[model samples]
Target: MPSLPLRAALVLMLVWPFLAQAQPALKVALFEVAPYAQKEGGALHGLYIDLVRGLGAGAGFKTEIALMPFARVPLALERSEADLTISFSTEALEGAAQALGPVALVDSVLITSLARSTRELPQLKGALVGRARGGCQDLAQRAELALRWTDISNFDSALRMLALGRLDGLCLTRDVLHHYSALASIERSRLGAEILVGQRPALLYVRRGLAPEVIAKLRVALARRSPVKAD
Candidate 1:
């Protein structure tokens, strides 16, 4: 028979495997992002939602979804309301969110009112353009567009301004404009969605101190996906 200390050590060693095997659920935060992550009848659907679930499978984690406003995802992670976020701009990652890498999940676009002949970023040179505040920095930077700019509060405001002819053009993501414009009676022909050449970099933010194996499994899965490309 071993001493009490040795017996305690052996008991801990025996229980650790069972404790580790009983993995905690991974809480993933998301918002209403159409064609990418949309919640209907309490279920998530789209490429990103699928991707996260797939990665979770690889990591042996059961994912629990938490739906919130787009702006609150990071805050959810901060408060431990979630263990991860669906996807967000890597540049915006701060606090407890640690970026894994860029996800080439969607295309960026330049939206123009029907009347304007702004076919692309270059054509909008010298025209007044509105960008969603803190959105599409990569597009602007990559395009090297030289235009008068304003920071609008959200895409809805920018879309309204465009309809009223307050702004000549706006930069936004494809599905975002696609989903929201239809809500406002804006036709696709009325709004030109020129898919930008460069890809928008999306990142998966995990809560700090999450099991490294989880992140590693995600990295492996991401690597196995289609390579990022211009649309």
Candidate 2:
């Protein structure tokens, strides 16, 4: 007969594969925003996507990614439908998840038609500005600007509105503006001016009550990746 220790080891070896297979995959959620998270050809790709994939690999957890509209991101976290996400720092999001500090930063800016003479926030007091629906627009209010706000479905639509003279300006990250514009083959001279509003840090957020070990592993991965600066 086999020794007691040998028998125990044999049992463990027999069930180890099943034990490993029983582990659940981490659920990660992201919103569709070009250059950050973009879905094309039914495949997801971009900065945040790559970061999350790397973190999951380093943490040794299988990760499942879901792409949805911005409005649903916080709601998913609130309902425990998602385990992780990356978003611009905002009170609304922080209320739903624990921010793990900034992984990147984004420059919020206002862009207008090249023909429009209004180049600054104060200059367009009451002018209509387009913003992505469900996005944070506290910058204008914080700056004490009473700009008329209009919600657009996405960056592509906002860019189209700006080009068609439907919106006085568009308020979003500078990189997003440049990205969509480039994709649409719009030239720099065609856009009026970029007014720097402020910089918002993009943070890695995990839903509350997530496994502490998982969070710790991600933190270690993030630290190893080095902090990404503003785009």
Candidate 3:
């Protein structure tokens, strides 16, 4: 018969694999970008929220989502305070985060103040334009505008600042503006004209140094949730 300690050691060796296979619970930081992510009736809902939950389920992971300010998401990822975040763009992607998969959820628009009395699209050169700190993607090449950019934490703040004449215009997704128009107390008619500035893909970002298997599972889950469209 095996000694008592030998038997105990064998039992632990068998049990440890099972424990390791158990799904890990992760904290996912979500931002209130509207239509993409937001809180409603004390629960989170939106395209990105649904996609994230579906991905987590497929990957055998349990997730708890907390709404966070947009600008703080990068810091959270860098600090390992949040395991996952969503809706990040190419321009915003940093070395501290690992991007999993892409989702086509945003098309940007540029909105200017009606109070400025400029009917035509104002030349952005030398203008004080407001943009959400981590929300804008693919806009860095517009260096010719010499834009006085103000980076706010969220869409609502940018809208409010523009309405109050603190900004000449705001650059963001039209869907986001429509989602928070009522909450921002800005009339839709007063938003003046909007310029379509092209669309870009958004992706889920996780803290760097995650296991490759975990990243693979996340990519498979996202692919199942939002299949890549043919060009």
Candidate 4:
């Protein structure tokens, strides 16, 4: 017969799978935005994707990433369906989730078709403007602009619409504009001057009332890393 210690070890080995299954990984929500987060060939890779992975390692927890629409991230966190996400620091967002820390200072811009001959916001009065669904609310609310804002399902389609004169303009981040424009082969000359909307802080957010220890570990890890910037 096997020794007592050997038999006990065999018993533990048989139950290790169940023990591992009982411990859930931290859930993260990410959206498709090139250079920040993207899904390619069934793999997630981007600046934020790498940053989150590093932070998870430093904080001593495994993570599971879910790709969803940007607008839905906050609700996921609010419902405890996800543990973390990256978003712009907005008054509305603050009311929804606890911000972990600033991840980057991103430039926002308003771009229109050069053919439209409109360089400034007020000039776009009564014109149709395209925006990512639930994005760029701050820019759209500028008192000087009196344009009709429309929700776009994707950047690719929006850029195509702008190139074809279907949209009068689009409000989005500078990096996002550059990325999708290139991917769609839209020339810079096709778009008018980018009106600067000022820099906004991109922040990491967690569900409200998350464990204090976890928040501390994540903040410490985040502080040790460099912030992402436009390429």
Residue-wise lDDT of candidate 4 within 1-231, one digit each (tens)?
999999999999999989877867889987668868999998998877887788888887789998888777877888888888887855556777898787777888888876765656677777788886667767766656677889887887898888788888888888889889989998887777677878877788988877888889899988987666756
Off by over 4 Å in 3: 1-22, 90-92, 115-122, 227-231
Q: How close to the true structure is residue 1 of candidate 4, measured as C-alpha lDDT?
A: 98
Residue pairs with backbone overlap in model 4: none
Ranking by lDDT: 2, 4, 3, 1
Tens digits of per-residue lDDT, candidate 1, 55-102, equal: 677667788876666667777777778888756463444665887776
RMSD (Å) of each candidate, 1 decimal: 4.7, 2.2, 4.4, 4.1
Better candidate by TM-score, 2 or 4 = 2
Predicted model with the maximum TM-score: 2
Best by lDDT: 2
Q: Which stretches of candidate 2 lie over 4 Å from their true place?
A: 115-119, 136-138, 141-143
Q: Per-residue CA lDDT of candidate 2, range 68-107, in tens?
A: 8887898899899999999876566879999987777788
Worst ten in a row by lDDT for model 3: 115-124
lDDT of candidate 4 vs native? Answer: 0.81
lDDT tens digits, residues 1-231, model 3?
Answer: 999999999999999988867757777887767777788788888777876787788988888887777777777777888888876564444766887767555667778876653534436667777787755555545776676778777677778777777788888876777877777888977665677777666678888867788888887777776643312
lDDT of residue 223 for candidate 1: 70
**Preferred candidate (TM-score higher): 1 or 2:** 2
- Pairs that collide, model 1: none
C-alpha lDDT values of all predictions? 0.70, 0.82, 0.73, 0.81
What TM-score does candidate 4 get on C-alpha atoms? 0.83
Worst 10 residues of 2 by lDDT: 134-143
